[model samples]
Target: MKDFLRIKVLKMLIPNQKKELILKQMKDKMNKILNYFKNLVAKIRIGKANTEILDDITVEYYEKKINLYHIARIEVNHSNTILIKPWYTKILPAIEKSILKANLGLVTINNGKLIKIVIPNLTEERRKELIRMNTRKLEKAKIILRNIRKEYNQIIKFNIIDIDTVNIYKKHIDIVTREYICLIENIFNKKKQEIRRI
Candidate 1:
């Protein structure tokens, strides 16, 4: 009879412990998704010369494709120009070609030793296009968050927990999803404003 009572007590405790663990895991996953969206948005340029603007450019160096940053030093010379100086003079042509192929709407100057890039000012029409692009990216992020919430909901519903516990978990998941969606919107608005100001 003592063993039976102990077993009943442990069963009651397990549901609460499981609920806590699930909540923590959901929070962690949501945070990871938010961080990723931030990094993705940071790469979008807004009319100024930024080193990260060249991050996506890959140069064909020594029969292998490598990132431009790995083989050269990139610096912002002024509000509108970026200077790239490679360690080896021979790779200058390759770097120039890579930047041109990237098609970032910037002009490149190669003087055989150092490369100078001029970032053009954004026109009103260009600003509108950029804003649209930003919106598209944000929409994609929101979709990913929704998918994550759906998966977690399925997990909670399938478990053999009581109705009250299931309702609580579903509510927690909805709260977390709403919070992350709001964060994404805030980031989008900030970036859109910056692009328009440029």
Candidate 2:
């Protein structure tokens, strides 16, 4: 509220922009929130072979670290296997070592030319843990959306002195926020099912 008041006072001193532009900016921010949430959940392993799980792992290529996918061609050889063929066969050891260092609990088999990652089956306990982690992430995302809605609501309320206009903007913000929350929920539901699929 204090921050809203400060911004309200500042608005009086500065030139006002179109309210539609402010609403558009809020929608853009909400889209970013959803995208970030999707990326966060994509990294969670669910007893299947997904290349995105290795998106963060960096391997040493010519004394400089590079993303695992950049240095190699990663593919899903099977439901439980990820095949990695490095552009340079000599980097097999480095790639294998980097995957091991990541501690993702997968078995890495390095042949002379390529590396195979065998994703292990998720235990019941582990699946539940992953679900809980995803639930926490989902809650955090929703909290962010609510906070953003509150911030925008305050801005609209202070800037537009008319009660009807302020209520309309607040209502629109609420609707958009709910839509994003539903999207986040759908993603989380799909992920939860994946984690439980065994």
User: lDDT of all the models against the reference?
Assistant: 0.84, 0.86
Residue 44 displacement (Å), model 1: 3.4
lDDT for each residue of candidate 1 in 1-198, tens digit (9 for 90 to 100): 985674465456546667667767777888888898887778777777889889889999989999988999999999889999998999999999989987567799999999999987799877887888778889998998898899678767665468887789899889989999999999989988888776
Q: Model 1, residue 70: displacement in angstroms?
A: 1.3
lDDT of 2 by residue, 33-152 (tens): 999999988888677788888988999887899998888899999999999999899889999889999766779998888999998888887788788888988999999999999988
Per-model root-mean-square deviation over C-alphas: 7.3, 5.1
TM-score of each: 0.76, 0.66
- Highest lDDT: which candidate? 2
| Per-candidate total of colliding backbone pairs | 0, 0
Residue 112, model 1, lDDT: 91
Candidate 1 TM-score versus the reference: 0.76
